[model samples]
Target: MEGQVVMGLQKLRVMIGSTTAIGLRALARLPHGTRLIGLAASYPVIERWLRALLCVYQPFPDIETATKYIRRFIPAGHEHSDVVSQLKQFADVTRESDYPVLFYLSGYAPGLSRVFDLGGGIGNLFYPYDRELRLPATLRWMVHDLPDKEEIVLQFAQSRHENRIGFSRRMEDASGVDLFIVSGALHYFEDELAVILARLAELPRLVVVNRTPFSRADPIVTTQVGDGYVHACKLHSLAATIAGMEAVGYRLVARWPVHERASRVPLRPDLNDTYWGLFFVLEADRRRRDASL
Candidate 1:
């Protein structure tokens, strides 16, 4: 009788939790319901318990602040060998989100020589893209990532006899590149896109930021607890990102939804957002116009 009662209570709790989650999500969709939910979520004790229960953690004002908190649990979550090894499995694979990037690259392939891949992992895109696109013989694809990833990428490149792909530790090396790409890693940095670009001496004509999370609301830093890893991710406003690019003399040429990735920062339905794929091109005329203004 006691065992049966315990099992019955467990099932009841599961059912109640599922029903509540579904109800909350449905409520978030209704008029002003999201605002009401947000107000309730803002209570300090409730927020702490909700975050703990959901495993999604707190809402931070910036990436630096979030990072400090996350480091207490895990030291350099992404730099682990197991994580890099697991990511290597996708080196030759292409997803639906990759098609948009390939489409843009097809147009610029003939003259594309230098590509600075910010936070690119061990030439994941390079291997797959080379098979599909007519890549230039003089291509120098630089993967900028953690120091440990360099040797791994170098060995991987050598294994395939790919002399075109290399590794760089310096962001300054991104200057004068033919193409600048930041796929799925832009949110890891504290700086805004425009702020980073401003530091570059000569901005690349083409920029592609893919599979990055962006919010319609103001930016907030959140903790992403993955298998054996934890990362501090900042979801910036989509409009702010576009405006920042325009401010840096780049125009939005294309934008697409990365439906595979989404962020639901627990309790904060207002902060939930899907990932985005964006393409930008530098315009000298726009630069001149902005300067004149």
Candidate 2:
């Protein structure tokens, strides 16, 4: 699987407003034969430093931490925090389940797209489960993102051989599951909200959504603003994303805050952006009785 070759430098520079786009362009432009060699030669120090840096920076991969990181830099509430409130409101709707299947989504990023992260900050949202090493009921763990990011996930999952995470297609060997989650991922889709819902409907039960945006597409992440300026990228407000999910089928199960303080990966500069917010999930048992069974 490969990422899409979309977004030219000028457009991307405006989108992410980062030099990373330029480097990715260079990396992409490199002939396949020499690309690896060129990357190794160019980034030997970066690779080594990252490897060593991983040793020092350790924190629970939980949702609260993610929200903390997001809120650290990007404005969460005021007007921004409305997204979190909507998620909380939705979560309030579901006072039932003790442990529901959790789905986490995030917007697309270059290197970060390759993992099954349920919410942000080294996948902090799912930390309790993974930390406790507990398995989800019926295990409908979801890792949602853009198609390109999902493509990256496919590649990485392939290399990992096998793990219970089951996001890997070969391992999952299935189209849908019990729960579907999208943390930061929901905002990217301004159109075709129905497709995401349809995807959710195919699943068996439960859904969790966190860190998504409402309308006007907040672009939750930051982009280089005018000159040195940085504009917060909009993520879908929780209400809008939930409404869209409801439009396609599926209902909100739970939403609540996992409040956490900001922490840094140190090596993962991307995680440094502050965020702290709610835990949200939506669920519906597969409607097509005995289908995909």
Candidate 3:
């Protein structure tokens, strides 16, 4: 009788939690609703409910099973293939046609003798350009990515026998780089991006960010499921991103829409479906003016 009563109480708690979650999810679709949902559906409440429901049938001695199950709902970082496939797709497109990056590069190439490609996967930008056109013999390109991706990028570079391309896991490797190119990757850094941007002792002459999703609405961080993995991505505010750059003595030089693709933030589809690109140049005059102040 005692065991049955405990089981009944567990079921009741699960039912209540499930209903709350469902309603919160629905509320998330309405304007100005996400904040409310974020508050009500706190991680603990959701985790507790998931645990009770998932463990009731077959209990596991190890906690790993539960952690794995819960993480499916949350965003973890991604592995090589998750990023490689998307980069390869972009590379293939670049090979066949003139893309915006190439257009921008043409205008700046004379001045850009060195480049740091942040979050560059398997040298996607370098490989295609190297094969299609002759890069400046004096140009040096470095790719910075997660540690796990270094080996794969090295192999890809070796396959092409491209000596100009180098790989590193450290951001310090980007020091003194003439150009900083962050393509299709900044959103992953989200709030952390500001910290990284601020840490640069000597800013690059130019910074180009491409395929970044932005919105007029408030910034949001959400989980994105891609290539069978869950990753955290942020949809930033265009104004805010520009402000951030300006804060660091960079001026917005150009802006455009990707047009090729859009990213929808699940519940707020209307707000963040479109992606944008931007270019910023260091304002030496402005920096000197600020220093004088």
- Model 3 per-residue lDDT tens digits across residues 64-107: 44335425333344573656667656655563223666666666
Candidate 1 per-residue lDDT, tens place, 9-46, comes to 64454345345555666788889878987887779887
Off by over 4 Å in 1: 1-33, 48-56, 285-293
Worst 10 residues of 1 by lDDT: 284-293
Clashing pairs in 1: none
Among these predicted structures, which one has the highest lDDT? Answer: 1
Q: Put down candidate 2 lDDT per residue, 1-293, tens digits, no spaces.
A: 12233324334433442343334334444466235533553586865643332221212233344335433333323222344334334422422221332233222111121233333222223434443334433343344432333443344435543233333333132234433344554433433333444543243333454443332322223221223222233333345555655654466544544223222222222223233233323343435433211
Candidate 3: C-alpha lDDT: 0.63
lDDT of 1 at 173: 91
58: Cα error in model 2, Å: 34
* Model 1 C-alpha lDDT versus the unseen true structure: 0.79
The alpha-carbon deviation from the true structure for residue 263 of candidate 2, after best TM-score superposition, in angstroms, is 18
lDDT of 1 at 119: 86
How much is 258 displaced in model 1, in angstroms?
Answer: 0.6
